[model samples]
Target: MVVLAVIIGLIFWVTSDDSGKNTANSTDLSGTPSYALPSAYSDPSASASGVPGVSGGSSGGGGGNAAAPGESPAPGEPGIPGGTPAGETPQPVPASGLCPDQNISVVLYTDKPAYVEGEQPIFTIAVTNAGLSECTRDVGKAMQSVTVLNLAGDRRIWASGDCAPVEGVNNQLLKPGQQVKDTIDWSGTTSTPGCETVRQPVAPGAYQAVARIGEKASAPITFNVNRPAAQ
Candidate 1:
């Protein structure tokens, strides 16, 4: 009887130990309990949908950062990547204004309308700004010409540029109603292309004086030279 009781106790002990091991393995395979987990932990795809203050999702389909509503882009700045804002026209950059030839006027004058046979003629060339705005111009000697034409056959008698050295640039800013004047004294003589030899004096007669700047010219003014009376 003592041996049989010992055998029954041993059998009960072995069965209980095997049952405990099987329960432990089943618990491991079943994972955590549903009631113990947080509510948001149920969905694994929630993280990829984007969380507040966190950037998420793949690079396609407007997944990048964006400006908030009611926000405006900086002035003259591009709003979108490689794109311009709709309904906005680009402003043109301003440029410095330049002077045109139509705004200038040239006038020629002589100290006296008539001079004695031996007297020299004093000539004046005046350039006036007739525009409403200010402008710059090259008023150098290279761009000026003084010509005298005899009325007999409308012959060209003398030109200031024929014997004068024209050098240097005279760029000047001309304001509205401004005038620039230049003066020269002309000998009672004539000049040609090569001024190597002395020229004879012009005959006392009626002549027209004209001044020119670039392609623009002043209106012709009549003048006269008289023969000297016997002393």
Candidate 2:
């Protein structure tokens, strides 16, 4: 009886240890993220690799690397170890089948390269899959932003999410060379978080704009905000 009791205790200990290890190894990507801000929105003074005009970093999703059940990991595997049985085909996992950062490209654009003060501008944020395989990424409003800065780019003048942001999850799969886009309209005014401050119309001048989804940011594009007289 003592030997049997010892065996049961050992089993319980092994399972407990396994569960604990899994909890420790797992990452919660959906919850409030404690990670650093993506470089595109980050302050230039924070990092040495920051872009000249704007601070930088990214949001990229890579395919999961979960190993097959009961299988051990091998070398050179990417993402979550999707351990698959020998000779069996592996299927793409939902949400988790993210594209690697190196294979995703983010680009920013405006309907017009210039806008007059008090005129609204429509901006587009585009994400393209540059890889050869189909992979998924979270492109929801929860992961996107558009920011406008002065020519020097140190101060943030306007941001899409400053007042009221609609949050939702939108995971999409993209084939090679496939691109997806999101658009937002700027009110030609300045804003503060939570709508706490009265937004004022921006003066005519040169400005820079950038778009991003999570950590992926497009190169900054310059646009002119001219006096209505220049229109």
Candidate 3:
């Protein structure tokens, strides 16, 4: 009976030892410790931003949601990244396709270079498109100016804009070598800065007429206003 018990004890000890060895070798099969999961195993629905199914970075592996190099935003869209909101239309960009200021020329002329006192001054402004291609310009009162200055060009005596309200913008497309002209009759009287009211008639003297558009001005044309001879 003692020998049989000894054999049974040896068999049991051997079986227990083999079971522990199998458990240690099985780690490679699961690729994870029994107490913890692998680092790569994460919830499929969760993202870094804490939003489900929505990723933080760019799609297609480009890294971020920015326009590609050398690409511009479509018109009416934000000009730069993180600019205008998604739906708001952006302001139009000024076009440089039109002719430059150097391609335009202005000329001021009057019906009579010498005017008798109390005679209305009939003036004309001529603008020529001297460019090689067609271009557009604002020919409205807002962009046009006619000024009368003293012979020395030191004193401004009158201006077309003083009493006139610039109604609206008039953009005209001018062909190359084309000319545009306008005429106005000025009261032979001085005016204040605002032209709110006409001042006294200008004294008999030599004066200059100047036509201007923005910073561009025509060559000054001289004229004389003389008192009428007594009958």
Cα lDDT over the full model 2: 0.82
Winner by lDDT? 2
TM-score of 3: 0.56
**TM-scores of the candidates in the order shown:** 0.55, 0.57, 0.56
In angstroms, give how far residue 4 of model 2 lies from its true place: 99
Model-by-model lDDT, in order?
0.78, 0.82, 0.80
Scored by TM-score, the top model is 2
Of 1 and 3, the candidate ahead on lDDT is 3
The CA lDDT at 21 in model 1 is: 100
Question: Tens digit of lDDT per residue, candidate 3, span 8-124?
Answer: 999999999999989988866788656755457566667856566778664575544567689984456456666643432222223755545677778889998899999999889
Off by over 4 Å in 3: 1-96, 196-198
Report the lDDT of model 3 for residue 41: 57
Summarize candidate 1's per-residue lDDT along 1-231 as a digit string, tens digits: 999999999999999999999999999989965665447553565565446556565567774355588887435645666554242231221244444667778899999988888788989999887777777767888888888888753787888888885876788888887999888678979877656657779898899988987777887898999998789
Candidate 2, residues 25-125, lDDT tens digits: the string is: 67444354677656456554565455465535543584557588999855674676477523323243346678766667888899998887789999988
